[model samples]
Every structure is written in structure tokens, then in C-alpha cells.
Target: MLYPNSSSFTPTPFTLNGIPGLEALHAWLSLPFCSMYVIAMVGNCGLMYLICREEALHQPMYFFLSVLSSTDLVLCSCTVPRMLFLFWFNLREIDFSTCLIQMFFVHTFTVMESEVLMLMALDRYVAICYPLRYSTILTNPVIVKAGLVTFLRGAVLVIPFTFLTKRLPFCQSHVIPHTYCDHMSVAKISCGNIKINTIYGLTVAILIGGFDIFCISASYTAILRAVMSLSSAEAQYKAFSTCTAHISAIVVSYVPAFFTIFTHRFGGHTIPHHVHIIIANVYLLLPPTVNPIIYGVKTKQIREVVVRLLGGKRGY
Candidate 1:
């Protein structure tokens, strides 16, 4: 029989430990976290500003990038401020409903980020491989439809996470050991059966992540083939150059994420909780901080526009 008090337990206001054993170091740690959040905010918001203000940037690639910037802004905003509050002010109490809301937005935006990245890859594929049809294929209407689909897909997939976490009775403890609420972390605290939670989480991860990865890989392969077919070295170089920033963004976003997922699920007693938390935090913060820089430095058009603005030139 389960513990006698399991069914009656109520986890109303969950306490977040904010890195558990490192409570004393929370102050020092918040410095870097704060810096990252600041950089992410400025970087993503600046990118959005540039994309919006410059008519030359009103292309499909930049449109996707603007969506990406917006997503990053939301994704990091969902957790970073709360994390800062907990670290700096020791405000650790988050009610159950708020926790679920955070989880929903975090996971939903993560899926949306993945879908957006995949769309970006598709955009590159068409731009490089089917240059002639690129304009006709990805029109304004199609781009808008794609954005809507990406949002709905992510929201629909992640909505179940709230339901799954809500129904479970968290009899073990109301204290979450990580910085922010996530599906697995929240579910793991429950004393009730969590098989359904685990199964659904894994299924969603595999179905969405697996499929997106496959599409990105396939798109890149075809892009490589098309680039290689180009007779001029300059043409091939230019085509490949356009993809470098996207590839870098993809690596930064996905690599640490998969590492954290595997380590959390399978590392067991071998992995330190703090290590898992740190990796999780890095994966969340790094992409937002890095993506804009990569695009700004690599994409000559954006770089030129930035120069023109700084140099006080008009008629951009």
C-alpha cells in the first residue's frame, strides 16, 4: 500500500530551492545569470528592432529570424526573472498554478523554437536548392501560415504537460530542487504513479525533436549537394556562408539541450543535481545570448545596416 497520507497531501505553494546545496553561492551565481539575461534581452530585442526598422530585412529569412528572436525573448523571460528573484531576494515560493503556467510557456516556447529552427532550415534549403522558385514557394501568406502552424503545434503538444503534472499528488515534497519548474522535475516530486507522465514526455520529445532533427539534417544534406553543384567557387562559398550562422545557432540550441535531457533521465546517482541544474540553465540561456551575435556578425546585410545606423546615415 502507498503511504497513508499520500492521497491527502496538498502541494499548494511549492518552494524552489534555487540550486539546493549551493544556497551560499546563489549570490555569486546570480551575477553570471543576470549578465546572461541582460545580454539576451538586449541582443534579441535589438535584433527585433533591426528586423522591424529596416525594409531591406523584410525578407523571409529575416522574418523567420524575427520570430526566432521573439521566441528567445519569451523563452528566457519565462524563467530568468523568477530565477533572479529567487536568487537575489530569496523569493522561492511559487504557487501551483503559476508553476504550471511557467512550465507551459517554457516547454511550449522550446517546441516552438525547434519548429522555427526547422522552418529556418527549410527556408535555407529552398533558397539554395530551388533559388528560382524560392520567391514563389515561400510567399508572405505561406510564411504567416507557417508561423501559425508552428505556434499551434508547440502549444498543443505542451498543454498536456500541465494536465499531467496537475493531476499527480505531490506527496514527497513541495520543494523543487531546480531554478524553475519543468515537467519532469515537477512530476518527479509526486508520490503517485508517474508512468504516464514519463511516457508522454518521452513520446512528445521523440516525436517533435526526432522529426525536426531529421528534417534539418535532410535539408542540410540537400543544400550541400546543391552548393557542390555550383560551378563557381565564389558562388559555392556564398551559398555555404549563408548557412553557417544558422548551423551555429542550431548547434548552440540543441546540443546542450539533448545533453541535459539524457543526463537528467539516465545519469541517475552518477550525475550531481547541481550539474544537471547548471547544464539546464546553460542550455536555456546560451542560445538567446549567442544567436543574435552570430547573425549580426555573419550576415553582411545586417552588419551593413548596423554600420549605417551608427554612422548616422539615412535612407536605409
Candidate 2:
């Protein structure tokens, strides 16, 4: 394939390869992905609805959980529908503009979700470590401000890489070997220099992920120290219980993401391309699908409300 000159190249519609090596299994794959998507939608939406309706859940922690669910809704919706389309109907051709749009939301909301998880961790830290000041520190105004900051941080940081990717001339080929248009996949298919794109993507990812991890770590460390100092075993157990759901949330959110990152960067030919693609999809869907289940099972208030609603009971 002789390459066209970058200077005169015209952009073309990108073809998304959904599970490259498993094309024959695309229909079968759609079943699981579709099921996960439905679960994420129902779970996140139901969680948000429950939080809004139940007076007992009108706390700082539940407020953050609502935000987390909302973010998860957007994060999963941004990619899964189109992925399913490609799987079920084999609609792989995506326009340049649409691809860019998908790339933007996919990344922006991913950052937002990470920030929300970090916020949830911080909320737990305050509730356990500084119970008296929890309300004062996490007021409505403060929560709103934090939400604005996270939204802005994601938009501002992500715009540069998206723009950088856009400027690259795709003379090599427009076939993106993944289910969705991500920064690296799109950039790699371009004929132009992607050094800046690669660097900016890595730098932003590291800074954002590193800072969130640092804050979560610091918050948990302080929380552990405080819990250990409580002389009563019952008190210690009660304090630790509040964090179980949050700790689970963090693990599900980051573990698959890091695994996908490592496999992309280091797996080379040792890892199958389809495996990488599946992991990437799982990274997006797992948190949203599991979050409501985790909180519903772990949080007494949510569980009770769910039971009452299902059993047609009147009072709280």
C-alpha cells in the first residue's frame, strides 16, 4: 500500500474493527454486551431515582453516589450502543466528526467518573475521620464547586489531545482496530507525526490518574489511622463497614483500566488483539453494571428502600 503525501491528504471515514479476530462471533458477543448495557442503564438510573425519592438518602455520600451513577450512565452510553450496532448489524463506518465526538465524550466522562470515585473516597474519609466536620466541609456549595472543577478539568485537558488527533492526516488508513475511537488508536492510523498526541495523552492520563490515586490513598491512610485509634472493636468494625462499597468501587474502576493500559503498552504480540479489545470494553461497562449492585447490597438505606418498593410497602 503506497502512502499518499500528508500535505495533500483528505480525511476519510474511519472503519471501526469490533473484535477484529472474532468477527464470526460478533453476534454472540453482542448478547453479553447488550445484557451489560441494559443492566448498567437500569441499575444506574434506578440508583439515581432512589436517591432522589428517598429522604433518608439525602446526604453528602448519597449525593456523590448519585453523581457517580450519572457519570457511569454517560460513560457507558457513549460507546456501547454504537459498539452493539457494529456487532449486530456490522455497521463499522463512522464519520470523522462523529468519531471525534465519540472520542471526546468517552474520555471526558471517564475522567469525570474517576474524579467521582475519588470524591466518594474523600467523603468516606471525612465521615470516618472527621465526623463532626463532615457536613461543614462537604456542603452543597462545596460539592457543586468540586463538580464544576472536575468537569472543567476533564474538558480542558481532553480537548488538546482530541484536537491534536484531528490535525493528524490519516493518509495511512482510516481503519481503527478497536470498537471505539480512542486517542492512541486513531493517532496510530494517521500518516502524520503522532509524537505530540502520544505524549500529551500519556502526560494527561498520568497526571489525572496519579493525582486521584494520591488523594484516594491519602484519604484512606488517614481513615485507617483514625479507625485504628478507636478503642472499641465494634466501633472499628462499624467505621470500616462504611468504606467497603467505596473500596470495591475503586478496585473495579482502576484494575481493568490499568490492565488494559499495561496490555496495550507491553503485551505486544503475546496478547491477542481481541483480548485487548474485550478488556477495553469491560473497563467501560463493569463499573456501571456493578456499582448499583455493590451499593444496593452494601448500603442498608438503599437496600431497605428497594425492598419496600418491591414489596409495595408504604412507609420507610
Candidate 3:
């Protein structure tokens, strides 16, 4: 479904090829897809609300978690509503400019999410490896500055990368083989030399996301070393325990994501288009839908607040 045409082109509206070969099953598919989006919206929203309401969650780790929740909400928002509509009502027509804008937000938010995760890892590293200086290092203004820098970094890079369409021609079928517009999916449709596009995209992926992953890994290595050096078993357990939610979040966010990426980069014509699209959807859907559950189950403070909130509702 990565359609790179062999001829010259003209600009036109694009029809999203929503779940090809699965058109007959769209009605059935919409149910779970809609459910996931709803859960994602509510779960992420609830987490943000709880963090804002509970004064105890104002620490650097929780602040990063809140940023992650916001990113997840926006990322899901970029695709899910339209995706649901595409599945159920078949509203797949998207004009060129709008497509570029949507692609900008989607990619930017994704970059922001990855940055926030790395920051969270750094926060954990500092807390574990150098606890006494955690407050001095990650004060309120520092967290705010980190967020602004993250947003600007993603915005600056992704906008230029996405707007690469202005230089190419689109004489091909306006049918994109994915639910929502992606940078590569959109770029590959152009009838011009796409070598530049592909190279730039891969560079952005490697530099932004790949580099962040390396930093996160290094941070965790330091955290583990510091944790192991603690003489008290209880101290070691406590330090490691703080990272349980973050580790769960990383797993849920990255595992399906890498699978989706592999399908895009290497699956070629051999893999089913619907499988690629579904896996892509899953990669985006799971984090927002499941992260709140992970933190709720892992973080004692979050679990306590959630329990109290539910119990209060029951009393009503």
C-alpha cells in the first residue's frame, strides 16, 4: 500500500483505503475500534484530571507522566475519530492541505511522546542514582522548560519533513492505503524522486526517536547500577518499584510500535495491507488506552485516588 507512482502528477483529494479486503467486516471492526478510542480518551483524560487534582502528583515523574498522557490523547485524537468515521460511515475523502496538517500533528505528537518518555527515564535515573539533587535538578520551571523544548523540537523538524509534498507531483490515485495520513504513506504517493523523502524521513526517525531510545537505555543502565549498589534490600526494592509503571508504559508503547514500523519498512507487498493498517492502529491505540490502567495498577497513589473516586461515586 505504499504507492510510489512511476508517472508525473496533479494535486487532488485523497481517499483513505480504510481496511482493504476487510470492507465486509468494517461493521464488526468498528465496534472494538470505537471502544478502544473511547477508553483511550476517557482513561487519558481521567489520568490528567487526577494528576491535576492531586497535589502529591506534582513531582517530576508525575509531571512527565501527565505530559505523556496529554501526548497520547492528542495522538489518538489525530487519527481515531476520523478512523472510526472511516470504518463506520466511509468518510474517507481528505484534501491535500488538510492531510499535510494532520500529518504534522500526528508526527509532532509522536515525537513529543518519545521525548517525554526519555525525560521520564531521566527523571527516574536522577531519583535513583542521585536522589538528594532530584528537586534541584527537576524543579517546576525545569519541567516546563523541558516540555517547551520538546514541543519546539518536534514542531520544527516534523513540519518541514511533512511539507515535502510541495516539491513533488501527485499524478497517482489519491487512495492512501492506511486509515490516517502518515509522512511516508503520503510522500510515497508522489510521482517525483522520493529518494530524498525516504532518506530525510529515515534520518528524522533515527536522530529523534532512535537517539532518544539510546539515551533512555543509558539512563536505565545508570539507574540499575545505582539501585544495585544500595546496601539495604528494602532500599533496592523501593528504588526499582518506582520504575514499574514507567517500564510497563515503555513496553506497551514501544513493542507494538516497532512491529508496526517493521511492517512498514520491510513487509513489502508480501504482507497484507489490512494487517499493516491494523497493527499501525494498535500501536497508537494501546498506549493511550492501556497506560492509565498500567499506572493505576502499579502506582499506589494513583490506585488509592482511583479507588476513592469510584467509592465516592458508589456512595452517590
Candidate 4:
């Protein structure tokens, strides 16, 4: 049960717990993060430009890639810039309301990205399993509906979770150990019993991440079975090739997610501070940086389009 009367709980003003000589460490970390942020932004922007400009790439798969790239760009922008600023100035304090807003956007985009992947898996399933009807099945109207559903799902699911987090009475230390205000990290500051918040978060994780992963796996399994029965070697090869990028993306996206969730729930504060920082950053930043590279390697047309759009002479 949630504790009522949280309005009376006075939160301590947040202050920076600056470690001595930490300026050097902050600089060391900021350099790499800034580089990664630049690469991720350029790569995703390039993907979006290619898809938008190239008429040949107007199909549903590339359409989904464009959406995913746009979402990644937003997600990266939401988290990384603030983190870089914090590290550069050693400003460790954030207003409570600002922290809540940041958490909302981070979780919202995270869910939206997961939904886009699920849509991508479904697109591949239709293309492979129902080749004759693929185009008709994935018409623009249908893709727009899928996008709407993804957006609404993220918005509706995250609203309640954010409210639940906000209602928690924070009467203890306000220093969030990690760079940003993660759900678990913020919940830790609440002086009241956090059973409700923890349970709600776990439930959302299972429903959002777990259910999406399960659906994607089921779609791909059906896809693999259909590919196996195809008599043509070329068809089988093509089918398998389409999935390689998505498979890599799924692995990269989920591993760090599960690691952070598991550590937050089970590891408690026993884990070292540095380890938590690493896992937190990986969960927030890795997908945006790696996803474009995965698509570039697996989808030749996208790579060609990206190259041409970047003013390089390349043909698919």
C-alpha cells in the first residue's frame, strides 16, 4: 500500500558530494561520452535524411527505421547533454520537479524504442511469412496506426508510473548516485516504504519490456520456420539476412536493461558506485549509438542511401 500524506514530507535540498580530484575523472569520462553522443546523433540523423530523401527507400521497413532513428535521437538528446553539463561543471544538484520530468521522458522514449522494435519484427514477419500480401498489409495507413499505438502505449503506461514515483515522500538523502534521475535511484531517496513503487516498476518492466521481447521472439520464430520450408536457397538466405541486424540490436538493448534492473532490485547498494554508473550509462546510451551501425551492416539499401545522402558516391 502507498503511504498517504506525502505533502507533509519535507525533502532535503540536494547538494553536490564532490569527491576530491574528481575533476580529472569527470573530464576523462566526459570526453568519451561527448564523442559517443556526436557519433550517435550524426548516424541517426544520416539514417533519417536518407530515408526521407530516397524515394526507393519508402517501404515499411525503412519507414520504421526512420521512426526508430528519430526516437533514438530524441532519447539521446534528453539524457546525454544534461549529463555532460553536470560532469563539466561538477553540478550534481537537480530540482525535484526537473528530475521527475527527466525520468518521465527517459522512460517514455525507452518504451517507445522497444515498441518500434516490436513493429519492425512484425514488419519482417509479414514480409517473410506472407510475401504475396506484404505490401498491401503494410500500407501507409497501417504503419501510421502502428506509430500511433506505440506512442499512446508509451504515454499511457508511463504516466501512472511517474505519478507513483512523484507521490513518494522524500525525507532522506537527495543525492542521486548516478548522473541522472533513474526510477530506482529516485525511489531510493524516499523515506517512506517503497514497496508500491518497486512493485509497480517491476510490473511495468515485465509488461513493457518482457511482453515486447516475447512478441518479437514469437514473430521471429514463426519467421524462421517459414524460411526453413522455402525451397529456394536464395529466399532462405535473404530471409535470414534481414533478421541479423535486429537480433544484434535486441541483444545489445536487452542485456544492459536487464542488468540494470536486476542490480537495482537485487544488488541493493552492495555494488560499487562505479559499477552502477557504468551500467546506468550503458542502459541509457548504448542502444542509440549501436542500433544505426547494426542496420547499416545488415540492410544494404539503407547503407547506400546513407552514403549517398552524406555526399559519398555509393550505389546499392
**Residue pairs that clash (backbone atoms under 3 angstroms), model 2:** none
lDDT leaderboard ranking: 1, 2, 3, 4
Residue 294 in model 2: lDDT: 99
Better of 1 and 2 by lDDT: 1
Candidate 3, 1-316: lDDT as tens digits: 3444422354557888888789889889889888998998899899999999989877888888889999999999989889888888889899877888888998898888888889999999998888899899888899899999999999998887665765667875678888898877877776667777777877787787688899889998998899899999999998899898988888887787777766666785888888888888888888899998899899988998888889999999
Clash pairs, candidate 1, are: none
Q: Give RMSD (Å) of candidate 3 vs. truth.
A: 3.1
| Model 4, global lDDT | 0.82
Please report, as a residue range, the 10-residue window in candidate 2 with the lowest summed lDDT: 1-10
Measured against the true structure, the TM-scores of the candidates, in listed sequence, are 0.96, 0.95, 0.93, 0.91
What residue runs in model 4 are displaced by over 4 Å at the alpha carbon? 1-5, 8-24, 307-316
Q: Candidate 2 clash total?
A: 0
**With candidate 3 superimposed using the best TM-score fit, by how many Å does residue 58's alpha carbon deviate from the native?**
1.5
User: Tens-digit lDDT track for model 1 on 24-120?
Assistant: 9999999999999999999999999999999999999999999999999999999999999999999999999999999999999999999999999
Question: What's the C-alpha lDDT at position 41 in model 2?
Answer: 100
Give candidates' CA RMSD values in order.
Answer: 2.0, 2.3, 3.1, 2.9
Candidate that would win on TM-score: 1
